[model samples]
Target: MSSRYAFTKTVKELRSFLTRAYPIMKKNNPHVPILIREGTGALPRVYARYDLGQEQTCSLEGLSDKQIEETVTSLVKPTSL
Candidate 1:
């Protein structure tokens, strides 16, 4: 997929996953930044910004396994899509 498409998909997936893990994620009065770095000739890298009192990069390397599934689930739900 293109960089923009990949980024969109990744962010959507993250949002869904976070919502499931933290029921109040959508209402967590905090601004989160999701960044995607597209490789020159390789797969894109996903990054997430977390400010749990301090800024830190979330360990999303191995955490996106469920992203596709969660994203798909959310897409099917009109209210949550």
Candidate 2:
């Protein structure tokens, strides 16, 4: 998976790739929680976590398309340190 994103070279590459991927997934499914894997707590890494309940709500609830798009976009964007 890392190789596909050209992140196989190093951990930094992997995190960068995952950071970019996160928004695409969130855009597709806004309600699901995204879990980023990292070392213990001090250091962070990118990862995906899916909850079925959240998925169901996103699918069934009345969420505007615009809102969903914005939310997903926010998720994928890099955060400030």
Q: Model 2, which residues run further than 4 Å from truth?
A: 1-9, 40-81
For TM-score, the strongest prediction is 2
Ten consecutive residues with minimal summed lDDT in candidate 1?
54-63
Top-lDDT structure, candidate number: 1
RMSD of 1: 11.1
Candidate 2 lDDT by residue in tens digits, 1-81: 744333223445445545666677779869876665444323222232233432211221223334444544554555532
Q: Could you tell me which 10 consecutive residues in candidate 2 have the lowest summed lDDT?
A: 53-62
TM-score, every prediction: 0.33, 0.34
Error of 1 at 58 (Å): 3.8
